[model samples]
Target chain A: MASLIPLTAPDDPRIDAYRVIKERDLVGRGGRFIVEGRTVLDVALSPRNRFTLESLLLAESRIEALAPLLAQAPADLPVYTASQAILDGITGFHIHRGLLGIGLRGAEPSMAELIASLPEEALVVVPLGITNHDNVGGIMRNAAAFGADAALFDFASCDPLYRKAIRVSVGGSLMVPFAREGSAEAILDRLAASGFTLIALSPSGASELSTLARPPRAALLLGAEGPGLAPHILARTLTTRIAMAGNFDSLNVATTSGIALHAMRRTQITPA
Target chain B: MASLIPLTAPDDPRIDAYRVIKERDLVGRGGRFIVEGRTVLDVALSPRNRFTLESLLLAESRIEALAPLLAQAPADLPVYTASQAILDGITGFHIHRGLLGIGLRGAEPSMAELIASLPEEALVVVPLGITNHDNVGGIMRNAAAFGADAALFDFASCDPLYRKAIRVSVGGSLMVPFAREGSAEAILDRLAASGFTLIALSPSGASELSTLARPPRAALLLGAEGPGLAPHILARTLTTRIAMAGNFDSLNVATTSGIALHAMRRTQITPA
Candidate 1:
């Protein structure tokens, strides 16, 4: 059985990994991401995923409740019990999820390898400047659902592996094979050379989404919520814009990706 | 000319509307929803929205930058100019967006009225238990892009007017005519009565999305991330699920909504 170390003080060295999570977010240096709450922890522990649990924090009163989940983790993963106050102090907020797990960063698939592995006729989503990790995660999750072979992030985009992103994605970020492509222009060029039907998403420009037919192998490229794709990239690719009903301007980046993927699926006559 | 109101303290009564903006998210009673950054403010000011500006907060140095936008607000809307410190104090954070607008909430469409108003051939998404207003907002934005006539939220969902949800949606929430329909079962029943194909989204069950052909007057139902549509609702509606390529269990709710709406549109196609 894995050991359950009881931490009495907020400053206990054994629980340092759980300390000041917010501050760590601010610094962008909290090695390994935090998965808070029980449901997220449950998803993280699913047999399909291969995550290494660095530690598990459980409220002393809830040890019995977490017994089944603890058993799922490998024997080496430690379970830590602490007072709610100490847990709160360490996290800088109330631990509403009542459980926490830290998962080590895992191996990332190479861009070339991921592409080479896909079926010859594939739908891929290349994300640009989508700095919000949740947005990236959601995009990947949707891409996965729609049968997209891969979800690629450009260098300017946020790390898809960020803890909250993975958790928000319900662990799909890990399940979907994603890699970081460098920039909008470079990726666009690479995609073009790759015989991809490069489609840039913009609210203001180009062919109406309803009228556009899907290409055999396509990349539905999306930009961040606001500035959208850089003008140069938009100029270089086939642009498809969703026709808004009345006054609405744009959907959230993630939502836009969902619609685009869905549209691509329809055009390709694939079940989404 | 609108008057420039200034206050130096975070506790000042003049700024009470902006107090505890973060904390007030729980009860959602007070605390002004601050839409920071210029891009968001730009969308809020579009002539087509229901929201109207009540006031503007501008840094002295930033006044010149906002002259054109400031000129667009009606003369009655208060334009408050203050030192950075005073604006920060009142706002409870640094004013990075350099522009702020206080908008008066507007009346929402009644659910019955909204339903009656839809064209016989249309795409409508009824979002349920989607307490994350941002996701709802994002969904609306996609709905608009995908040519859906409207988006309706079930009563249990979060207020579309919540600040973060609005901001995350890129102000799409305001542009889409969203009504708070209190009951999912009631609305689902009404859609069925109206001859609308009510498709409940779930991963594990129902018809594959691709097989559907030319469905007219449809409502794509979605729940929040994780819990999805309550099983009771799922049991009652026409079922359809997004097809997946890998082991990922689900898609992000907003993305799922987008893909579903797009897929449903295929069913909306008229044989040409």
Candidate 2:
């Protein structure tokens, strides 16, 4: 079991990483991320995820409830306990959930290295220009929920590891293997070269999603909310649309990812 | 065309409804609600919706840009103009979108009245305990996007007409007809009485979504993120689940609505 280090002073250098968390979230720490809440910490501690927990800071009131979790962590890891006021002082805001952890990103594999390691019948989600952190997180959650082997993001997309994104994803962002590399075209070229069928989601697409047949290996290409997939990207894949009523033509990109991924999963089991 | 009334002071009694909008948004202003931004105001102005506009407030620079919309408004309706600073003072914050409208909810029909009005082959979305305004708004957007005839919300659900919900829905809450009334069981009974097939969405559902055949008249019963549908509600309806991978079982309720609605729409055309 890890040792419980009491933290009475807010300015202690050991807990400096937890200071002004909201501001630090803007200019993210290099190779490190904050995991908040007991539920997310549970995911972070799981051996399946690639994140390594550096330390944990818990509110005194919550330590008793989280004893089992703390007992499982490596003995060398420091577990700190602080009053709610001290915790708030460190985080620069009221953290009602009262559990926080600093985590380091594991070695990130190159896009080629990641893709080559996937199973032969892999399903993946590719996001382009999805700059909203919430959408990126939501997509990761959906990808994990729907059994997508991995997520490939273009450089234009927001970081999936952003604090708010990680929290919103319920830590599914950490569990899902993702790599943000290359331009949209370059990623598309690589996916196509790997014998993956590229399917671009767009409102103007000719084929309805229900009627389109899924390939043995599929990569769903999604874009930002308003502008949707760029014309060049749409041209390079089988363009399919989620049919909508005439009055409203759009769905939030994250929600679109869920529907598209679910549809892809269905097609895999029951061929169209 | 709407007559442009010039407002020189933020404390003007005629514009009292716009004061401290964020706070007023909590209790809400009796039967009235504020609509923000150009996109949402566009939906509020549509003649098909059941909202009646009391007045409009626009930023000075936006007056000329919104001329077409102003021309379509009832001639006697007042369109107020204020400088950005004055608008900010009245709203207790920066009004960056700069367009606002005060709309009165028209007579809300009884649940029976609303359900009875739907077509014989209607598809509906029923949210049981969705207290979050964003989720309610998102569900409304998905309902509108996928052509669900109406939304039926139980008392446990948040007000779909709430300001934040309306904004998050991109005005979808206005375009789609929705009513929050009765308990979950009462609403289910009403729907069943109206010849609608009740299908509850739950993580523990026995049937996969793709395998379930669509009913001619369907009502998708949904719940909040964590608790999902209550046990009794699930027992009363045909429980269905979106087949998820073993690692993660949850999807955001709004995303689930979108996927389920799309699946229902697809099944309507291409029977299982």
Q: What is the DockQ for all candidates, taken in turn? A: 0.56, 0.81
Interface DockQ of candidate 2: 0.81
- Highest TM-score model number: 2
Tens-digit lDDT track for model 1 on B37-137? 57667666667556676567778878778777666666677777778877777766767567766666555568888888888776788898888766765
Name the docking class for model 1: medium
lDDT of 1 by residue, A1-272 (tens): 56788988989887777785666552223447677666567666776554566888888878888888777776677788898888887888776557877777666567766777777688899998888877887886677666677887788887766766776666666556677867777777777777788888887657877667777778888887768888888888888886654455556677777677766776643221
Off-target runs (Cα >4 Å) in candidate 2 are A269-272, B1-3, B26-29, B64-74, B269-272
Query: For residue B128, what is the lDDT in candidate 2?
Result: 92
By lDDT, the best candidate is: 2
